[model samples]
Target: MPLDPGTPAEAPTRTAELKVRGLTKSFGRAAPVFAGISFEVPHGASVALVGANGTGKSTLLRCCLGLIPADSGEVELLGQQTGALGQGARRRLRARTGMVAQSHNLVPRLSVLSNVQHGLLGSGAGPRYWSHALAPRRAREAAMAALEEVGMADLALRRADGLSGGQSQRVAIARALVHAPRFLIADEPTASLDPAAGEEVMALFFRLVRSEGVTVVFTSHNISHALGYGDRVLGLAGGRLAIDADAAALSERDLGALYG
Candidate 1:
């Protein structure tokens, strides 16, 4: 069972990139999505979250990001107790975190550079997203730098609608990097791409994380990718933290048991 967040005891020192203790959540008349789950992601670490559908992996990510409240326990991220903060603080915190979702979510008519600039919207220091066409030269240069990192600089002037699934995902990554966030959360980022493209994107994702020292927490359906790319593997099973171990210690057979 999940521990109460209001008890005299509070979550301990917030040293990890992300941490959750005794966290839980549920909708009415349904089993709890998370029941007393707990885990920690260290700074500059890459963690792969694996679980069956509807197991709350995405929900946990949301709670960790302070986008949604956990019904009990607590979530701490980058030194802030997420649910304890006011809405403004949460928004600001989210602004500092980069997020890449399953859908590329790029504006079809926008050029790759324009789409990348959208990442700056949450930076809180830039021109509004709608007026990015007239954004300061500094913003453009920053967007280009991010694009260059993702190997999408050559496509900067190309329309997003014209790019393939893999290209779009890379551009999406570029967009996420435009914020220069220290932490990044990605959900099924390669689900829509072909195997070759998926491999390319994942290779790029881990390469960037390794080179830039960014903390990453991502979800994946592929057990092999999870084991190969992450230093830690977290298997969310039956509404609990079923498996939390070093990726090297967990084999594909071990991870497959979580799905079963």
Candidate 2:
């Protein structure tokens, strides 16, 4: 039986939630965005991927999620090698994960509740599950519970396009969490918000994910957020992983080199 959306399933027993080895990606004939990047994120850890713009943090995150194929490398997610997974296998693997982006990515005309319910689409749910009006009572309850966790349930009936930057992000986070994912990937989650909003959102995001024991991999340009929220920080520079250290062992000064 499927677990309740409000109840995260027991995380699979895995040594590492993610492992990347010799990962490389590049456009046709151009220099590689990054090369030979390797790392391992143990289950339940939050990792911050940081670098100057164009350092391929987003590409690396996508590769890790199997959203994009790497040029030449191995990526293991949840104990399965992504490259070796066939389409059906990959889809099943991805169903166990969730993602958020800077753009919010909400369907503008949709209600916030509907947007969050969309998270269940990965479950191969039927069209009735796609809209709040037609969604099963259980699906609506689950989505509402997710929004409540993000402090956005009160706005459930509002159109997503009508929300503020911060509110939209909360809705996005709710959508990501609605399916009770064991692994969460976020790219520049706070990039679109103002400083104060960004800080608050980051705090809430980590708190909820941590409470649920979700393993998180996120990218951030905000050094403070990276250091404050990450258990480990990784900096990419010059097509390589230039910094990989426990967040407690590093500070802003340690990450400045990636930007220089």
Candidate 3:
């Protein structure tokens, strides 16, 4: 199947928080994972990526972040081209972005506060950071503020391993938020939690979008969550961007066909 290179009918200007033009990736002897995909996410906009399993949703996001290099095209984030930047420059760019994976990547032995404090590592401290890695008063205060945002301040002293799936996800969000990132990329952030738990996490995530004005892009398997929580929904299928529409304008039935 040929992947469509269609963009949204109406979108923000080039001043968007993220912009992709002809983005593509492939492995040897295999078809392209995604091809010529293009889009823009304006500052403070929330975007949801939805597709069936194995549709290249995860790979596309990784490519956008430059964790996995794309075969062609460009991804500009915060006015920096991810593919063309040097490592140090890319690190600096990433400092302005945050990430959350499906599995809470918290260090089990670390306290919740410590795990959240670890988020400060992206801020470009010097080598002395490793020698005295523990959170300083200022860092701890920032981490606490992030925790308070997620309603997890009361459990700051608890070990990460002791928290439930929902709590751990909240802590992970706090870790992402500690830097006050201008953008956040999340891959299946609430996948492991139960429905109620997922709702709580989604609520908190949306609140961050509305209140903090953080531009967000997250992948979702559930159509409702994608449409309900995001300002725009982009659907991937057959290695193409099959749908790009306002979340409010799309229906569950409209998205259901894409999954099939």
Could you give the candidate ranking by lDDT, starting with the highest? 2, 3, 1
Clashes of each: 0, 0, 0
Q: Give the poorly placed runs of model 3, Cα more than 4 Å off.
A: 1-14, 126-133
Cα deviation of 253 in candidate 3 (Å)? 0.6
TM-score of each: 0.91, 0.94, 0.91
lDDT of 2 by residue, 1-260 (tens): 88899998886774798999999999899999999999999989999999999999999999999999999999999989999999889988988999999999999998999999999988777788778999999999999999989999899999999999999999999999998999999999999999999999999999999999999999999999899999999999999999999999998999987888
All-Cα superposition RMSD per candidate: 7.9, 7.3, 7.1
Which candidate number would show the highest TM-score if scored against the true structure? 2
| Model 2 / residue 140 / CA error / Å | 0.3
Question: Where is model 2 more than 4 Å wrong at Cα?
Answer: 1-14
lDDT of each: 0.87, 0.94, 0.88
Q: After superposition, how far is residue 25 of candidate 2 from its true place, in Å?
A: 0.6
Q: Residue 111 in model 3: shift from native, Å?
A: 0.5
- Displacement of residue 243 (Cα, Å) in model 2 is 0.5
* Candidate 2: C-alpha lDDT: 0.94
Q: After superposition, how far is residue 136 of candidate 1 from its true place, in Å?
A: 0.5
Q: Compared with the true structure, what per-residue lDDT tens digits does model 3 show for residues 1-260?
A: 55466844555453588999998889997999889899999888899999999889989999888889999999998888998899889898889999999999998987898888878888875433322145467887888889999999999988889999999999999989888899899999999999999998999987875798889999998888998998999999988899999999999998999877
